[model samples]
Structures are given as structure tokens and as C-alpha cells.
Target chain A: MPQSMQPGDAKAAEIKAVSIGKTFGAFHALKNLSLDIGRGEFLTLLGPSGSGKTTFLMILAGFTAPTTGRLMMDGKDITDVPAEDRSYGMVFQGYALFPHLTVEQNIAFPLKVRGHSSADVKRKVAEIVERVGLTGHEKKLPAKLSGGQQQRVALARALVFEPSVLLLDEPFSALDKNLREMMQQEVKRLHQETGTTFVFVTHDQSEALALSSRVAIFNHGELLQVGKPQDVYERPSNRFVAEFLGEINLLPLDTVELNGETAAGKFEDRTIVLNKSITLAGKKAVAAVRPEHMFISASPQTSDCNAITCRVEGATYFGASTKYHLRTRSGTSLAVSMPTASTSPIAPQSDVWVSWPVHQGFLLPDGG
Target chain B: MIGKSITSRKILLLAPLLLFLGLAYVVPFLGVVRWSFTMPEVGLGQYRALMTDPLVQSVFIRTLRICLIVTAAVLVTAYAIAYVWVRGSSVQRMLAEFCILVPFWISVLTRAFGWLAMLSNRGLINTWLQSAGIISEPLALARNELGVIIGMTHFLIPFAVFPIASAMRSIDERVLLAARGMGASRTRIFWTVFVPLTYGGLIGAGLIVFVFALGFFVTPAILGGGRSVMVAELVYLRIFQSPDWGLGAAISVVLVLFIGALLALMRRFIKPAHLIG
Candidate 1:
């Protein structure tokens, strides 16, 4: 094993799940979910807690057996294989470094277990330790290192053996925002450099979007959608995916109709058009618009845009953006986020117009 | 000084226990040391006899050997029980605790007698073996080194298990899972990760069991069948039966010094924090 195994050197594994289901006694954790992870792909499983993303990740790692399913690796049945036999590197949520071992020993554990010679283990340990920026701290125990340093040790230990797949369960959840972003970039760089198949699980949507080549959104034991981050974020299949990814404004509409590839719906007293068409048999539907897409102004600004008049009830000032919370005359609530640099701050309780271009809003089945 | 002022107040609170220890343990121990040295000629007569006495040397060696055996056996058995206590389900944990507590709460003499009954020739074990046609005659199971070891190990097991179990409970469950994910086999994970993590508990338990075993008197006397003459039995013989108080005091002094040396050696390897935390 080398210190930093190249992506081309790794045997990146392609994994497929066939209708996997898991049950803990009477409670079902995951239901009939099938997903195929391509070789050398950074696929992230994104979901809220208890949405079975971690369970699915555990099943993929072969730590948890599915009650009913078949897992295949490169078309070979591996459902019965144990985690040790699978040789998948996992950076657990807490890092899980051996408290008794120094950083170098912890990184060299896998190599030593595989019966490598002392010289080979030493060389690989030195290389990976330096690669992880842990050169002078190789002799320091896990308890002596800071959280980010310990995290790097875990990452180095996992990558040193050049496993077929790398599984991470919210590895950055414990880190602060700045360190998390830095680690995420480090993870992405490592993935690109090694070209190893990476399966990451996280509830943080931004993290999922920033790191993954493909993101799998899960909810209520079901795989809601799996696609590129842009595809999933821009065109969420349902209201859950739409709202879960980020803050979205959903407005109930009536008499929904699909004309060619555009959706038209009646909202309040005006007819609105959606850029993307959705097939909903019922007349009741909802128009889902992202908070950033909606622009708030002291008065109506555009003639052909979809607009609603409302009172600004609240304004939250982020560093780069300000979000205005508004309530319509009919008591419907809406939110609009605008760049702080471009827009003057709107006072709370001010009457404003929340509008978006016709193509920015999409329609979804109502009450789902 | 602030430190002196605080210590003065603290001394008032600690006065009762300090008085009790000084009167109850320290004074008596000092008396024994004085008697051992100043009994006959106020010289090294008892010490010289101890060096030249073959009987005393044999008993001291036998005591050391038996204590070592009991410590090893108790450590192994306790570790197995503690592992189960940590990883097993509720019922298994309850059962393991029950087994350890039963021997722990019972009187030491009663437990030794119980072992004596079970291990005595023609007792439960030998009778069963004979009935099963495994042996033509009853085996010498009791009143020997093996019998003494078994009885003492049973007595020391609960003491050994608690510290190890505490250490085991402190280990993060995810560490083992991480090891398995990193391609370590089950046995490898146990030895490499799990065992090393429990070293503090092992050292604490080992110190407790070995020190207590060194001074053991009851179980060995009952189960040893007069064949295993340990230091405690020799002390008893010298003090009570033979009426040689000076010699007994000298042997007691040696035992105390040996235990102190063992503790000092172990203290270098085991941090006091590990024992408490």
C-alpha cells in the first residue's frame, strides 16, 4: 500500500442494490430501495435524520444486513459478505481513532493487519501522514490532537489502505463551519486524486450539493430522487424534495393545466405559468418557488412577472443576503431572499411586492 | 498564606477520618513493626532465621506461585465475563452481574467451603466422573495447589471484573465498527483495539487481585488440604500454634514489604488516574 494511492491505481467498485428492505422487528427502516453507484463516483445520500440514509449507508458497507434485498458489486452477489471482507474504508461520524495508538500507528493499522513488512508500513505511514498534513504530530495520541487534526488522521488511515470504496457518515458534522468547508474541499480533492468510489451520507443539503457528483435524496424510508445536484435542486420531483433541499415558497393553486411543456395554474385572481410542466391529474396544485428566485420590492416592478402583494412581517440579515418574510392579504406566508449588496434593507411591517419571473416557479401536486 | 489557611479549614473536616486511620490501622501496624524488630535481642535474629529457614522459604515461594496463578486465572475469567457484560443484551448482562455478585456477597469462608465440597475426592465432581466410568478411582481434586487456585480465583473474579467492565463500558462502540471497516478481522480488532483500550482496567484489577491474593488465609487453608503451606498459614503456625510471635511478625513485615514493592512497581506503569477514572 502506498501513502497516497492514485485514483487510477484504485479498483473503484460499482455497487448496485436490488429492492433492499430493512426491518427492526415491527419497524421498517428502509423500504424497497434500489440505487446504483457508478465506479469512481462521489455519491452522497442526503436526508433528514431517521430518513434511513445512514441505514442504507450501513447496508452498503455490509455492517447491517438487509431483511430483504440483494447487493451486487460489479455484478457479483455480495450480500453475505462481511465488512472486513469488503475492504471498504469508512470514516465514522466521530472519526473513531484508536485512543491508545499514535497518529502514525493508527494510520499504519490496516497495513500492519495485512501483514506488510515493517519497512513497507513505515514508508506508507510516513507518506500518508505527510499527505494529511500530520508530519510532526505522527507520535501524538488521538486524545492529544484537536478535532480537525483527529479528523485528518481518520481520513489518512482510511485512505492509506486504498480500499475499493470510501464510506463517510457525516464526517464533517462535528466540525465548525470554516473547518467543515475546508474538510469538504479536502475530501473532494482526495476523491478526484484517488478516483476511488466515495459514498457519503449527510443531512446537510449544502454539503451534499457542494461535494457530490450525484446526490440521492431520501425521505420516510424511500429514495425520493437521485440525480446531479443541479437537477435535483432545480427540478425536485415533489414538495418534500423541493422544500428539504432549501427554503422554498409553496403556493396553492387551482385549475392546473399543462400546455405543451409549460404548466398554468390559477392563483388568487391571476393566472400563473410555470416554466417546467408537471402532470397532476387533480385541479388542486401548488407553485414551488425558491426563496432566492423571488424578488421583493417596495412596489410591483415587472408587468409580465408573477407577483403577489404582501406585508413584510420580518427581515433576517445574513452577511451577504437578507431574507424578507411576508404575509399576503389572504394570510398566506412567503419569503424572498435578495443580495444585501444590491438591495436596500426593507423595514419590517412594510407592504411589499413579492414577484418572480414566470419561468422561475414550478408546479407540484398539492397537499402531498 | 492562602494555602495554609485553606488547609487548616480542610484539616478540621478531615480530622475524624485521620484520627480513625491513625488509631485503627497505622498505630497497630507500627506496633507490629516494633515487636518484629525488638522482640528478643532488639536485632536481626528473626530476619537471619527467615533467610536460613527452608520451611519459611518454601512457604513464601509457594504463596508467590499460587498468587500468580490465581491472578492469571481470575484475570482471564473476569475478562470473558466483562466482555459479555459490556456487549451482551439486557438479560445476559443481568445474569453475568448476578454470577459475579453471588460469589462477591457471600462470606469468603462459606465460598471456600462450597469449593471444598465440590472439589473434594468423592464429592460432586469426582463422583460424577466415577459414575460416568471416566475414572476407576476418585481424583485428588481438593486439598492441593489446584484446589486452592480454583477457590481463590472464584473469590477474586468479581473484584477483577468490575474495573475491566468499567473500562470496557468507557470504550466507544464506533471504534470497533471503524476497525472492522478498515479491514480488521474480528479477532484482530479484539486484540488490537479492544484489548489495548482496556489496559487501565486490567492493571487496576490485576493489582487488586494480586495484592489480596498475596495475603489470603482462608481458602488456601481449607482447600489446600494442608499440602499448600502458603505464607499466611506459616504466619498462623508461627504466631498461634508454635507461639513464635517475633517470627510471625517478621514474616508479616516481609509480606507487607513485598506487597508495597509490587504496588510501587505497578504504580510506575499504571497512572493513578486510570484506576479512578
Candidate 2:
């Protein structure tokens, strides 16, 4: 929770990207994206492929120059500085470990390049190797190590220099699921230990949510939203952000009206209430709720909850939870997930009451 | 049994190539080896004479020296060209490839003659210098060891460029970027990371150019103008000019053994996989 310090606190803004845009010929890779990375914060740029997240990371690393923007660091513009002069550490996708160098040499490269004494290089390399749990594998080449081991070497190499900022470009994308999770925990621990500003890019939403203090959602070269993981996931600003984060049930609403700190709208025969207070620019809106927030039962659980009657069309059993796919009378499809141990075996075709807290549902402009 | 049969079938597919090499290369080489030993009334006299002859010793020494110089020069020049080929902009890469391949497609004799036309005394270079009043006399730019070295280096640059460029192309570009991001300067990245990664290519190209330079016949013969005689030219002289078949065969055997020893020495430094790559 190092990001608890708000980005608006000017002193905490370690790196600020202002009005960044990149275009190649006729194709725009990134629009005028503006963001602030707080000091010692773990911020993940989450998006689908071709969302220009990687392009932004490259700009921050100084590997790619912005077409029109000013990159500020410590209140100074660094837009024209080259990558080598920026002194930021980067872990590229696929690790990019030096194939010809041994693990120790690979980790020692940055130190040696900075003209550290041989003794200092050796001591630092040994220390980081042990920190990454690669003590015994120091003498091996990258090709001789496993995928996870190579990833550790890449991490150790990037962190050994004690850079002020660390940028990772999908470092764990090549690992198996188990190893990727393990590496994720390792990176989280490293981030806490180093207290360095970390900007990570990944297409995997779960990884973005689990590791980052704040996740910035991107799509089609635009910065859609940036916020704390829970805030963004629970209350996405648009349809793309809601859908990209995870499975969400969207029900069309009509005659939407804004109340003091809530919005009341109608969905067919049910009156839907959203907890967020916002100005409505259009009459049409959609009620958005995560599948996990909704529950299926034979009867409505409480009066405070928004409830709808739907026919269960199908159910999918995941080891930990059962997902019931339901369709309302108006032909709006919805999904409700319940813990397997707590749910009764509701057969398909059974009519049920799907209920959720009114505060859990949010409203988005329809088709946005 | 099935595995054995499959292996045998694969070997059978190599029958024609094996037959051709055995007849065209191994068989003639065996004859030369036999003549080196048995010629001149079944004794090692020719080899003993080779050891004592000053002309043969100087020729061998000079040939080794020239080949070493050419190999070094070709490697340094080819590495620059190969780097441009792999990492340059599209226009630069196309220009580099044109420079390498255009000369490569032209015959060696044509290239040697071209060098002669430019470098020989009273030729283009000398005539231009004289006309420009830069020199009172034409310089001895050709018809010596320097001429031989220049011609051989030019003839062999394209050979060295291919392997070096291929090796450079195989390097993961991210490794360089990673180094740069870690604050390594461009020069440090090139010397420490880029060059070391292409070591396999450098070694492979060096071996090819050095081996080819050792037995170079046309460039040295035409450009040397009978002065700088390499092992191959000496072998031709002894066999065809002096008609001393036994001495020539002895020299040829020694050359082959020298190349074999070089290969063995090089194998200690490079892995077979690196050579193939």
C-alpha cells in the first residue's frame, strides 16, 4: 500500500508522463496518454494485445522517444535523455539473459559497466543471487537453467544495480501458471524490499490486480482508467474496462435518474439502484455487476438487494465455485457464481431469484 | 532392429554424395599421400629435402604470414560490414548487401585484374597521383606481398561476411536493450555484450577465411607476378614447371597436415554446434 500516498502529492510523483502520443505512418500506437507513477508504487498497465501499454513502458524506459510529450522525473523533464543515461533497470519479456555469460556474469553486467570494483561486483552479485534464491546456480549459463531460474537471473540483474525505478515488460508471460504465480509473489516481495517505483506491463488481468497497488486499464491506445485495484474492478468507468477486468453481467436500463449519491434506473420490471453518484449525459444506461457479486436462490434474500427472476439455462463447475448461467424473461443473459460448498444443486431450467446488494451494481453509459 | 534399419536407410540416402567424395577427393588425396612416401625409390628423401631447402622454408613462412594478415584484415572489415547488415536501417542494409554481394559474384580473376588496374604502378592510382603532382614516381602498390595481401583480403571479405552477419542476426536484440537500460553505454554494450555474442560467428568466419587464404592460387599468382609464392603456387610450380612430382606431392601432404592440425586446434576453442550455427 505504498501507493496510499496519492499521486496528486507532487513530491511523491516519481515519474510523470504528460500528453504522450506515438504514431507510425498512419497508425497511432498511443494517444495523448497522461499518468503519474508515485514513488515506490507498483503500477501495472493492463490491457489486451496492441493496447499500447508496452509502447508506453518503452517511452518511460527512454528506449522509445515520445512523438509529442514531456516525460518528467523528480520535477525535471527527461524526454530527450537516452535509455542508457536514464539508469532505470528493465526486465524485458523472455528475460533476455545474456546467453554467452554465466549467471553471475549476467547479474554483474550493470555493476561492471558502471565501473564497480571487482570485489564490489562479486559481493553484490552474490548477494542478489541469494536474494533471488539462485545461490547454487550462479556458475550456469542461461541456456543451462530452467525457465523460472532464468527469470530469477533476469530479475537479479535488473535489481542488482539498485535503480530508482524498475520496469518489467511481461517478465512472467513465458512461465507456467504455477511458476508465474510463484514469481509474482517473489516480485511483490522484491518491490516491498527495494521500495523502488515499479511500472509493470501485462495483458493478464489477474496478475495486474493481484500484484499492483494501482492498475491502469488501457485499450486501443487510450488510457481508459487508473485506480486502486478494488476501486477499478468494482466500479469500472466504461463497458470496456468492466468487461476487460473480468466477467460482468450487464442489464440494459431505461429512464436513468441520478439521486444525491445513487442512481435509480429501471430494468424491465425491476428497479435497479446504483451506489455511485454521477451526472447522466444520456438517458440510456446499463446496470453492471460482477458475477461473483450476484447470488442465485429460490427466493430473494433481502429487501435491500436488487432481485430479478431468471431461468437457469446452464451451470459450469469450477473446482472452487459453481457458475450458473441464467437468462431473464426479457432475454438478458446473466451469470452468477457461488461457492461450491455453500450452493445447492440447482438444476438447469429452474426459475430462480438472482439477488445482489444495490451498492454492488454500478451504472455505465449504454454502448460506451 | 527397426532403429538399425532406419539408420541404414538414412545412410543409403547419402550413397551418391559419399561415392562422389570418395572417388573425387579421398582417392586422389590417397595417391598424393602415397607419392609423398614412396616416390624417389621408396624413401622419405623428398620430405627431408623439404626440411633442408631454404626456398621451401621461406615460402612456407611467407605463406603463413600473408594468410594470417589477410585473415585478420578480413575479419575486422567484415565485422563492420556485417554489423551494418544486421542492425542498420533498411536502406543501409541494402547498400551493405550490395557492396558485399556484387564483388562476390564477380570472378576472382576479374577482381584481381581490377585491383591491378587500379593499384599497379602507372595504373589508375599512380597515374592520378602523378597527374595531381602528389608524387614524382609511381608507387610499388602491386606485384609483391602487399598486392597479394590486398587481393586475397578483398576476395575473402564476402566469405567472412556471411557467417558473421548470420551470427549477428541470431542475437536477441533485447539483450542489448537490457544492457542499455541497466546503464551500460553504447561502447560498453558493443564490446562486452554484442561482440561476445557474435564470437561464434567471428571464429567460424576466421577459420573459413584463413583456410582459404592459405591455399589461394589465382590472386597471389596474378598479383604477386612470380614474387610472392604461396604453398598452392609452389606446389603447382614444383609439379608443372620443374616436373618434380615427388617434391610437389610432399609439399601438398604437408599443407594438408597443417590445415588438419589447424582444424584440431580450432576445435578446442569452438563447439561443433557453434560452427554449424
Candidate 3:
């Protein structure tokens, strides 16, 4: 965590895209999108399927040509440059290791293609193999290895050449849960140690938040927003980003009044204030709060908290936390998660008070 | 318990095939083997004579040489066509697939005759060249080793493409993309990644075509013009023209043994399980 606070290394490479667009027979895979990838920054493209995040990553890697716009690396136009000329390392979703090649040979392929000497290739391959914790698997074919091992081989191969940028397309999606977490840590450590620019694509929001310095949310072939993980999570620009990042409770409010940057609204005969008023003057509005931010109590606790009376319909236990499915008195379904360690269990079908600080909620125009 | 019943059911289903193979193929082939060694007071006499006979030796060598040429030609042509079939657009793939399979739907004899029509002296190619003033006279395109190769390769392309394209299909498209991303040029990716991954298909197709070509009778008979007699035609001539059944049986036995030896050698050199397993 401390390492993430440090600025990117000065030697890191930067990539810039200017108004990139791609169309395949009138199907717009990527719209007119522009973004700047900082040197040595971990940027994640987060979206559901068909959201064009993978297409954008492909365009960045030069595997796909943008229908309109130019890509620049260090201010040099590389829009038409082929993938091989870009010299970026990529780990595909399936970890596409050459089936015939042994792990060592697979890791050495890029170096050998780059005309590295045999000794240099060997040294680099050995170091990367060890770095990726695949020391004894050097001579084993990819099919002979486990899925996790094959993924490690892919990571090692991609990182062996010290490429200017490393692009990963859901590298851990195929891995089991434990292996996925382990690989995530491994990738983060490698990114930290090498300080190479990394552009990762995944639909898993937790993965996007955990591994990236900046998360770019995509939906319907358009970029919704790009910012730091906390910024994006706490202050999503629209309803899509808010609900997509995690479990959110959207409570409809009426007669909203804006006061500077804050807004007060009436919901279920109770006055509630939202800290961030991003809604218009006279439009339907909803106050969105993440499940973890809301609290469920037997009775209202504080005057400062925006509280609502709800009936606890059910509870799902998650070891460290419990999520209570609740329905407000006015019949809006909502959920609130409370840490099991600090909160007592609430019986199902019981009336409860759900409350959170006004500062924890954001206002968005309804039906966003 | 369920697994045992399923396996028993599978064996029960296999009973008919096992019975048919035992009666129809194994029995007759065993009879041929017995006749080769036992007929006309034979005790390795035919084998010894076959080794020493210059005519038989030439036929054997010629069969092997022609099979090698056919296998190589079929492999190269099939690899190109299979590559297109796997990686090209749907239209291009359909066209390539259609061309490769044209020799299959039509009978082999018909295709050979078609080739003979186009390749004979003063045939379509020669006439075109002459009319276009590219040459002074007709070229000998048929009834030679070149003609045999052309005809055989054409017939074997579809067989070769099946295995190669199946192998190519199993290769992840992203692997090639990853190679390109890692600075491998298109040509480099083909040789290093694409070709090596498809080695299983190549070897399987190669063994199939080579073994098939070694025993070919019709293509070589029509296109060989008697000057390039292969082993199968030699066996035919010994039995039908000269009325030497024992010699023909001996040659057939040798051909089977040569094929077995070649398969054994190929197994030793390349383990077939590496591709499939």
C-alpha cells in the first residue's frame, strides 16, 4: 500500500490515445475515446461483456487498428504500427502458451525473436522462471502443467523481455479463487518491482479496484469514467458505474433542494441530506449508498445519520460480514452489510432502522 | 457400479465391429501371410530372392521415393490451404476448403483421368503454351514422375488438410496474437509458434499419406507410363501378366513389412501421443 503512494519511476513509458474509434461494418466496437496512460501506472479497464474494454486494450497493443484517431507512445505516432513493432508484452485470457514448447523455451521465445544471445536468453529465462515461482517447471510442456502453472508460465514469458508496457486480458479469470488471489499479488509485486506500465482488462470490479491505481469503467462501448479506485468507487459519475462497482441501494427521493454542494430530499416521510449533489435542479433523483456503508440497527442511533425504517426480509452470512436484505416501509428494496464482529445478528422479518452518515451517500439523477 | 455398467454397455456395442473385423479382415490377411511363407516350398526363398532381385529393389526404392515426394508436396499444399481454412475470412476459407475437397467427392479414378486429360502431351496446358507462343512444342506433363506426383498430391490434399486443420483449430488464436505482441514477426510466429504447435497434425497426416502412397496402384499405373513402376504395380504385373502368384504375395508381404517398419521408425522418432494426449 505504501508503495502505491510513490510516484511512478522516471524511466517508465507513457502512452496516449487521441480520439480513437473503431467500427466493424457499422458496429461501433469503440467510440471516439481518448485517454492518457501514465508512465508505470497500473490502469484497469473495467466493464461487463460487450463494453469494448478488450477492444480498447487491443487497440492500445496495436493488435487492432482504430478506425479514427492516432496512438502515441512518448509523443511518437504509432497508430499504424503493427503489434510486433510495438514491443509490448501481453498475457492473453487463456494464457496461450505454445503447446509444443517447454516453459523455458516459451519464456525465451520473445527474447530469441528479439535476437538476444543464447546466454542472455538463458539467463533472462532462468531469472524470470524463478521470479514467477516456476523453477522446476522449466522443461515441462504447458499441457503437462496445471492451469495455475500454465498461467505462471504465461506471466513469466510476458515479463521476461522487460517490455515497455504489459497488457493482460483477464489473465486470472481462468484461475481458481485461491490461485487468482495469489496471482493477483504476484502481478502486483511484479508491477511494483519492474515499474513497467500495465494495462489490464477485467469485468471483475474487485479485481479492478484491488490491482489498479486508476480504474476506467466502460459500458455499452463507451468510457463512463476513469479515476483512482477510491475516487471512482465513492463518487461514480452515473448510476451504471455506481451499481456496477458493487452492491448499491438506490432510494428514490422527492422534492430535492440543492444547498451549495449538498442536497436535501424527502424519502418515506423522512428528510435525508446527500453530501454530493450531482443531480439537476428539477429532476427525479436517487440517493445511492454502497451496502457496506449502510448500517442496520434495532433502533435509530444518531441524529446526524440519515435513517430509514425497514423490515429485514432475509440475511446472507458471509463469515466476516452479514448482508441484510431489507424493504423500506414505502416498499423500496435495499441491502445493508454490517461487520459480523461488531454487529449482533438481526432476526429475519423484523423491523429495523437502516442508517448511514449523509456524507457517505451521493445523489444521481434517477433511471441513469 | 454405474461406471462398470457403462463400460460393459460400451463393450456390448463394440461386439459387432469386433466380430466383423475378426471374420472379414484378420482372417484373410492371415491367410495371405501364411501363403507368402508356405506356398511353393517357400522357406524365406521369396524373401531372399526379393532382396537380391534388381527389378524388385528398383520398384521398392521408386515406391519409397515417390511416396516421399507425394507426402512432402501434400504437406506443403495442405498446410497452406489449412492455414487459410483456419485463419482466413469465411469466404476465403470456404473457397480454399472447396478446392481442397474437389478431389475427394469425385472418384480417384475420375480425378486421375481428369489430370491425364489436362496433363497429356498436346493437352490443355501444352496447347495453351503453344498458342500463346511460350514454347515451341508440347511438354511431357503426363506419364512421368512429375505427373504421378501431381495426381497423387491432388488426391491426398483433403486427407492431409483434415488433420492439419484440426490441429490448427486447437491452437488458440490468441497465442499468435501474443507472439506478435512479444515482438515476433508474422513469419517468425508461423515457424516458431504456429508450425510447432501443429506438428501433431503434420506428423499424423504425413504418416497417413506416406503409408497410403506406398501401396498406391491406380494413380501410378495410369500416370507412371510403365517407366516409373511402383511397388503396387510391380505386384500386379507379377501376378496377372507373368502368372507368378507366389512372387506377388511375397512383394505384398514386403510392402506390408516396409510400412510396419516405417511406422515403427516414425514412432521412435516422434511419439504420436505427444500430439493427441
Model 2: per-residue lDDT, tens digit, B48-130? 99999999999999999999999999999999998898899999999999989899689989999999998899789999999
Highest DockQ model number: 2
Write the residue-wise lDDT of candidate 2 on A102-208 in tens digits: 99999999999899999999888888888899978989999999999999999999888888888999999999999999999999988887778899999999999
Question: Best candidate, lDDT-wise?
Answer: 2
TM-score of 3: 0.91
Q: List iRMS for all predictions.
A: 0.8, 0.7, 0.8
The candidate that wins on TM-score is 2
Q: Which ten contiguous residues of candidate 2 chain A have the minimum total lDDT?
A: A1-10
Cα lDDT of candidate 3 equals: 0.87
Q: Report how far off residue A30 is in candidate 2 (Å).
A: 1.1
By descending TM-score, how would the candidates be arranged?
A: 2, 1, 3
Q: lDDT, candidate 3, residue A140?
A: 91
Q: Score the docking of each candidate (DockQ).
A: 0.80, 0.86, 0.82
Error of 2 at A354 (Å): 0.9
